[model samples]
Target: MPDATQDAAARILAAVRAIPRGQVAGYGEVARRAGLPGRARLAARVLSQNTDRTLPWHRVLRADGRIAFPEGSAGYREQCQRLRAEGVAVVDGRVRRELMAGAHGDLDAMVWGPPPR
Candidate 1:
């Protein structure tokens, strides 16, 4: 099972890496995209230990679009700043979905392109 676990981690990392700049996805959504449904917490755990700064860990949030950090904490402030730098509006501790809703709320479309016009 070690290999399976390692692969799962890899998949989760890949999913997180796939999040486009200026856009964000929920932890649950990231897990689902990694083919690990119902494992949002696992995704969060993996992220907490993430050392690769390029992974864009700030792009992952609760399903409600809120940053997971305490409202006034350093992490909260940093995440808000980083997200805003990417042009993702975080208003009232939650991302305004309309601003970041370009594509991929649907996993299939995220992997493949939208259906023919």
Candidate 2:
């Protein structure tokens, strides 16, 4: 049987794997989906130690839709490139919230910000 750590990692990995291509999820969101709310740091840790080259780790981002890597870093550039290849609009290292995976709120409001008076 897997230990608690292993189980948590498994669940987190599964949650990450479930994020569809051309979409993205926040680290906190991934943790919540994996039944480990408030474990966003754990999610990032697991991804950092990931050995599976096939895992779509780049699909996970900060809650505010920003890439976690420092700007101008190789990781940052690669992440941006990967997301753009999937048709996701990335601007200044920030992804549009409307393009985030599982987003179900008001599309117009999210895409265009608050409506004009």
> Who wins the lDDT comparison?
2
Q: Clashing pairs in model 1?
A: none
Which portions of model 2 show Cα errors greater than 4 Å?
102-117
Model 1 C-alpha lDDT per residue in residues 13-109, reported as the tens digit of each score: 9998888888788898889889999999999999988888777999998887889999999999999999999988889889976433333356446
**Per-residue CA lDDT of candidate 2, range 1-117, in tens?**
459999999999998898878878999888988999999999999999999999999999998899999999999999999999988899999999877744754322344577566
Residue 100 miss distance in model 1 (angstroms): 5.9
What TM-score does model 1 achieve against the real structure? 0.85
